[model samples]
Target: MTALAALVDFWDEEIDRWVSGHAGVSDRLQPWFESYRGRGHGEVRLDAFPEPYTGRLIGNSTPVVMLGLNPGAAVPRFQAPGGVFFEQLKTLRYSEWAATVPYASKEWESIAGPNRFYQNRFAFARRLLGEPNWSIANGVYFELYPYHSSGVNASMEPPGDVIREFVLDPIGDLDTQHVFAFGKPWFSVPARIGLPPGRVLSAKWEIPSREARIYSLPSGQDLIVMAQNGYAGPPGAGDTEALARAIGLR
Candidate 1:
């Protein structure tokens, strides 16, 4: 099968096994505070608690890749956790220009509606092009930590194997032109991999972004590491400009 097909297979058939140890999580989500006690602040064993990679596989036509941190309350661990979204993925799996399976809103959300990140990413994309049409513009939208969670935090580095297989490998093969990692969590991979070993040119960029610099891989794809935190939390209310400026979309 193709790389994209392999990714889908991993999410569909292989991902749901995270709930094996728990009784009712398969039926309904078990709160992280209840079952897996320390997940929020501790290590997430990828081999045992494998969370499927969320987000749509909206084909490989677009030029850029927007990588997020991880899912929030909306995209529960299981993509088809027995609900309307599950049925959505069932239909979306066959089509190319669609697949908002993990989009929390609904299937065809990307095709039929405004995407989750489009409006958020406008802080910069807007300046590049007025009233940015984020719709299906990026080739792939995913997270570095694809493991499902209830807003939990993993270590600086997750299992290398998981990264190599699900993230790095797929990105290497995909039609990726530029990779924009949103937050510190998503940006850590580049350091661990030890690429160009340089600093960003922009001095005005904030903390995490101030530390981040752009690098290119052998695949001829540019990997941009931003130094700012993700567009999350209360402070994030003002993070739009910093994010845009940090990534040079400003």
Candidate 2:
């Protein structure tokens, strides 16, 4: 099987194991699951416990890959199991579901309508690629950590195999042009995947001053890591053109 197909199978098996209440899987995900469950915050929910990856999986066409710290609580709170979103997730599997049900789909919007986190994150792709909507955009999103949580737990370390197979190997094998990775923690990803360290560059958005570090992979694709400010908070209005120029997209 191809690397991408293998990755899909990996996700399917993991999700199945998780949903079936596999003791090992439950034990593995307990920390992250309980972290949000025990927080005593009404807004924090864990109906959707683990999400390994989302968005359109890379295929024949070269896609822009967006990397994030982890799956946020924002999505699962709405798209819980038994809902249309989760139904699609179960039927199509993640990669196929993501491809079929783009973030712009009414099915997604109906459940998680106008989510600031997703909107802000996808804004970079919409602006940089000049795609008017995320539905038509050619991209995929992966997380450094795959579990869902309201807040990032710096101490939580994903299994080494998960890191290698899910994140690093797919990244190395995919035919991608540019990878826009958000969060300071991800600066080490390129190096971990065998690329040299990246050089940091700063970009000023409407909110805070954000940094975009650029790395060139051996395959000649560029990996641009940015501060988590814009995506985690509000949309960085007018960041497109300037960011495009800074990252050599313009």
Q: Please give the clash total of every predicted structure, in order.
A: 4, 0
Candidate 1 lDDT over residue span 1-250, tens digit each? 7666676665554333433333123322222213333254343333233333443453546445556655433333333345444444444432221344333344536444655444455334443333455553443556655434445454445544555566666676677566666666645566566555655645443345344556776567777666444443111323435545554555
**Predicted structure with the largest TM-score when compared to the true one:** 2
Which tens-of-lDDT digit does each residue in 1-250 have in candidate 2? 7667778877777666544544144554444334322243333344664566676665637566777776776465335655566666556666676675356677667776765556666666777766676454465777876655677534434444555566656776677667777776666556555667778766666545566678886557777777745343312647666677776677
Question: lDDT of each prediction vs. the true structure?
Answer: 0.48, 0.62
Where model 1 places Cα greater than 4 Å from the true spot, the runs are 1-5, 15-59, 74-80, 90-98, 101-118, 122-131, 136-139, 194-196, 206-210, 229-250
For candidate 2, what is the lDDT?
A: 0.62
User: Model 1, 111: alpha-carbon shift in Å?
Assistant: 18
- After aligning candidate 2 to the native by TM-score, how far in Å is the CA of 163 from where it should be? 3.1
Best by lDDT: 2
- Candidate 1: the clashing residue pairs are 51-148, 208-227, 209-227, 209-228
